[model samples]
Target: MFGRDWTEKDQSVIEHHDYSYIVYKSFLKYLYTGVISLPMQELLELLDLAIVYCETKLERCCIQEIKRGISIQNIDFLRSIADKHKKEDLKIFCLCLESRNS
Candidate 1:
């Protein structure tokens, strides 16, 4: 850990290989502005970032965006994501969507 009088040697660079540059940039923008608008795939990537960083608000926002774009084709995939992330709201929402469509 760097002390109060940090120097260039104390600087650190974190890397995220799984996320695209645009997705990472949008995440930083969202952190400052509390706003994000991106395609569903990018939103999913952002959701992963949020989960990794424990950003519950951003995670909720991403889930809302995913819900808006959800369809029969993507329900399973999204549900799996919800399950993987332990997002009960999203899992319940996916279930409701499935039931409604049935």
Candidate 2:
């Protein structure tokens, strides 16, 4: 991480070297407004970015949104993401949902 030696102008020019433009912009908006309204299609990618940045609150929000959007067709994909991210709670939730629908 960059140290505290940066000027305001330097800060302005400092890119979010960790995330994509869309993900970073959405995250910045969430920081400002505490809300994000991106399409479900974008949630997983944002979740990955949130995990990488150690943004626990943002990860929780993403997981909630993913739960709301889940369906039989996407359960496997969601489970895979949960496993990949070590989100055991989400993995359990997805498994329960899958069992209920089976």
Candidate 3:
């Protein structure tokens, strides 16, 4: 992590590493509004970034959104994301859904 102390002067040029522009913008908006409104693909990306950044609240929000948006088409992919992110609840939910559908 960059340890450089940020000041008002740096506000104009401060750059975050790793995240794409859209992801960073979305994250900034979430920080401001405590809400995120990305589609599934961007939500997945944001979730990964939240996990990496240790933003547990944001991660939980993303998981909730993922759950709300889950469908038969995206269930397996969502399950994989849940598993990879150690979201046991979401993974279990997905598993149950998959079994019921099958």
Candidate 4:
């Protein structure tokens, strides 16, 4: 581990967060603290954090939130997230979910 303390001193995430940072931090935590509290957001970043980390569960949770409109406004981003998680079959499901609301 780096000499620097890995404590979560910063605000949970980057103000302009990206998929890479999310995955990198998730890796760091699993490697260090043995805890993985996924970030909660009013708006999920369009960048697919799970694709980068290859964490299907997290991707699912985030996309679900987006479809619920409790998160960001980026269908393409959600689609990519779904595709990355080997959930391409879910694209129709998600699209259907999205359409029902609108």
Top model number, lDDT:
1
Candidate 4 off by > 4 Å: 1-43, 70-90, 97-102
What are the root-mean-square deviations of the candidates from the true structure over C-alphas? 3.0, 2.8, 3.1, 8.5
lDDT of 3 by residue, 1-102 (tens): 234674645465677677778888999899999989998999999999999889999999998999899999999999988889899989998999889999
Q: What TM-score against the true fold does each predicted structure earn?
A: 0.84, 0.82, 0.82, 0.36
Q: Which ten residues in a row have the lowest lDDT in candidate 4?
A: 39-48
1-102: candidate 2 lDDT, tens digit per residue: 355765655564665565568777898898889897777767788898888789999999999999988899999989998999999988999999999998
For candidate 3, the 10 contiguous residues with the lowest summed lDDT are 1-10
- By the TM-score metric, which is better: model 1 or model 4? 1
Which pairs clash inside model 4? none
Task: Give the Å shift of residue 87 in candidate 2.
Answer: 0.5
Q: Model 3: what TM-score?
A: 0.82
**Whole-model lDDT values for every prediction:** 0.91, 0.85, 0.89, 0.53
Q: How displaced is residue 33 in candidate 3, in Å?
A: 0.5
Candidate 4 structure quality by residue, lDDT tens digits, 50-92: 5465766655655555555422365655666567655665566
Clash-forming residue pairs, model 1: none
Q: What residue pairs are clashing in model 3?
A: none
